[model samples]
Target: MATAKKKIHYAWWTLVALCIIVGLAKGALNSSAGLFIPGATQELDILTGNLTLYFSISSIVTMIFLPIGGKILAKYDIRSVLIVAIILQAGSFVAFGFSNSVWGWYIFSIPLAVGGVFTTVIVGPVLVNQWFKKKNGMALGIMGAAGGLLGAIAQPIVGHTIANDGWRAGYISLGIAIIIIVVPTVLLLVRKSPQAIGLKPYGADTASAVGSDGAKEELDKGITLAIARKSSAFYSLFLFFLLITSIASFAIHIPSYIQSRGYDVSFAGNAMGAYMIGVLLGALVLGFLVDKIGSRNTVYLAMVLAIIAVLALLLATDSKMVITLATGLFGFTVSNSVGTLAPALTTSLFGSREYSQIYSTASLGLAIAGIIALPAYGYVFDFTGSYTPVLYVILVLLILNIILVTFAFRGKKKLLTQGHWN
Candidate 1:
């Protein structure tokens, strides 16, 4: 008798683990923070713009720590680093429960950002790059989709919890719950690399040896961090990071934006749920598109989708259908720019030889956008009593990103001609 064998790749297991770890951190905790803002300010009598300063403070900390954190990840065990990261990130949420003063957020934002620099910014792409040589773009997309799926579930629950129990209980309960779930998963599943498990990366048997770093190799396929930094491609990519983040940071303000249009919190919650659905769909579609069409083409398509989303919001303010559709479209197209576009762009531009170092350094734009853009939007709304001006700014930046993408690829061609991509 012949027996059938079941086969499943360990890489997929690692990806699933990441989906949970990052999903809870980003989709649950980070995504839900905006829901807390309204309640926190109303109860504490703080101004919206003033309270948002804590976000900027967190961004500043993230900017300072990203490079340092990349080094730490390369040195430490993934399990140990992530365990500590979850504690800091989730514990800060628990601490926010007791906060009466805005200074508490400022104080807590330090550890929060420190932890987030790893869990949110650095870990996913670094690990995905090391694990999957094939379907790398698709892997990044799945991670984004997971975050969206989890966030879709979390947004409404958090909103309902805040509406019923108040933000204090909501914060403490959600924080503690996430810590309990994520810690064990990290301890059991996550590893720094396929090599640590005595296995080559997924698709290793058939793929190029470009990543293996044989001692006798005469040339490298990717540029070094030193070379990458010196090129115009680097700056253009940095602007892409900055501009995309600045545009997408509007998601954090979606609830506020909806309310300003005379919608209720429940409607805002539903709109966010729709947005997460868009994220889920967009992540998958963009990931597949990048694999089929390449990163450059996928980015052009995402920007076009973004333009339509922004225009819908501008022209159709009176219709609930239009607002929800626009918001969902915004989430689908723009939100994944940081998660999927940034890492994939890094690979397409420079290859994966110095991926961690180059990606981390380039991602300073992400942190810088948080510090500058997030609060700037809040302050703009505070001053003008509308998010209208912010939308105009985002539209301009989207157009500029299209131009920047063309320039970055031209620089890559320059590097190739110079024999730097050996």
Candidate 2:
């Protein structure tokens, strides 16, 4: 038989398209949720503490449904799932415009969060994994940056909308706009995977994936959930996510944080945008580092930067130049909670076969953090009339995160030696 040659496929194009849709939808919703805080509380005549519980509701929904979301994604057609998810998320956003009662937020937050799991949390990584057999970290990083880029655009627009037309209009317009944009792009462009369309993974041809195939590590050995549950490393990594995300959860409060410190809403919004810019920068740089230097070193670098950034935030919160620098630095370190560490660490520990399950199981830490931290910030303000306690807590969490990362790496090394990886 004659040797065969390969041809370029359309799957890479599909991945790029999904990235754009997924990125825009995630960017607009997740990044802009902070903009709604002030108005939701003020208009509904509710305590800020009460209105913020909506976030807890959303987080709970995401945590509960994450595994189901994964199984559904694996079972269904990608295009169909995405369409339903977009409508739920984007449509609920528009419905938020009409909500005069707090119950609306509590109820609809379920669908919105379920949609969020599909679009923002699960889609990018799963889609990338399907389409690109190589450079996956880079692809995911860019997808992560999409929210930052969109946030860069959305934070300012949301600030202006609330300032001009009130928060109602802002929510309605952004919600409808995201649906309009994402639906068409996803429907027309995204394919399920390379294999679904009869092709090899992107970069599989004339790329390092082929050359590196000979010594390919045992890439799909998934420890059962029970076995993984029993590992010390699992708890360590969970704490890593919990603490790190608790720190990053500050992003949602930055708008309120700034206004309390005598900054204008516009300036606060701009600061949020700048913070997201730092997220884009950090996600890209660190992801590249993980690909080059290994996930272990990249994590330590991220943790150290987080420590410096938190200390900076604690000290420089009152100065314009210093506040921006500190918050931006916080953005840099905190995004590893969502952007780099989870997926990287998930693969490192459990491999690919059970990746979504393990990742989702570990993600309850984010929900748990929200349940505890969101209300804690509100109560702290109610008591002390300040965010200083929140800052101190964040610093403590980041320091603990460093210790967790070290243990996770040490555990992975042991797993490899035990032949779980071979």
Candidate 3:
């Protein structure tokens, strides 16, 4: 008799679909926004600053919509929510292609950001939490890595398209491509939970076979959102989100810092390439570390690495090679905030009981950081004629995160003791 082939888990399929969908939404659509600015401003005779105000508008909308999006995702069918989200996001990009003035960008940016709240921010972590009982950190890491790699590939293609065919074609083409690719992927592969299909999450059977009740009960193990909101853990996690984001925002000023130190734009570009590579590799390594060690330990390691990177930047200015390496190290550490660490920390501190709601509420800090950090760094450089002060501030914030992570876990202990971790 022929041996029966073992079937792969649907959770893995869900992960694959998420990799493609989120990758394109982030890499192709969101990351490519800056490439169009030169073309849009030159063609439309709009001031670059005025045209970029759409980004601020997008940020504000994202901040306002995040909590609402979290609530919606928790209450609705996952497929339907994601389908509507991609359309709003990609549809806005398509609308940008047809716009003739800066006002058009400002107006459409609202829906664009609204869509992003679901597609890029809330959906991936929430689904992964629902689908995987084991290797959840690795899953988040893979998603983040995929997005980085896809963004790296997409940027060049997008730049080429805009250079050859113009910004309008680039915007419309990429937008339509996202919808075509993502909508079907969601409909076919994504589900609200493994239980929805009468299957357990990946590794859940192993957990059951080891004499535990099952994954469903395991999934339900956590502090409720109301209790979590009242805990020190939640507030510590919130500050972690804000401060880490603020620290990572320094990436925007890196090229200027390089130029200020007498390196040319070419060198700065190469350093940025190194940084991207670090982010890609960092996601994979951090995820694996989270699986092997745990999220808290992984966070501790990341903070230490960040501290080293900052020290290298501050002290190793004489060597071009050192600067490049330090930038890459910095990128590796900071990529944690984007997707990997935030979700892992949430699961570690609060469990999956009300993950979407709690994670999204904590992520208010992310949107707030976006609005404040970039301009704050710019103004610091403008007033002082150097980025040194900003670097020192980042170092301070990095140290603070280590303390916050410690406090967060302590708060979790308190919750467990108080019987709030139901």
Give the alpha-carbon lDDT of every model: 0.86, 0.76, 0.83
Per-candidate TM vs. native?
A: 0.86, 0.86, 0.72
TM-score ranking of the models: 2, 1, 3
lDDT of 1 by residue, 1-422 (tens): 13322456678888998899998899888887777777787799877788788899988888788779999998988889999998999999999999999998989999999998888878998989999988776787788789999988888787777777888998999999999999999878888789888888888765675545572243345888899899999999999999999999988888888878887776777778788888898888887788899999999999999999998888888888999899889999899887777788999999877877898899888878888887788888888989899899889999999999999999998988898875
- In angstroms, how far off is 168's CA in candidate 3? 6.3
lDDT of 3 by residue, 50-162 (tens): 66667678899987887799999999998999999999999999999999999999999999999999999899889898888787867877887887777666655665676
Model 1 misplaced regions, further than 4 Å:
1-11, 67-80, 125-138, 187-219, 222-231, 351-358, 413-421
TM-score of 2: 0.86
Clashing pairs in 2: none
* Tens-digit lDDT track of model 2 for 1-422: 23343544575566667666776776677777777777777778766667678888888888789879999999998899999999999888888889998888888888899998988878887878777767776677677776677777777777888778888998899999888888888878888877766788877765653565444544556565666666777788787777767777778888888778887767777777778788778878777787798776777777778778767766776788877777677777677556686678777776775676777788778678877777667767767878888888877776777778788878767766766653
The order of the candidates by lDDT, greatest first, is: 1, 3, 2
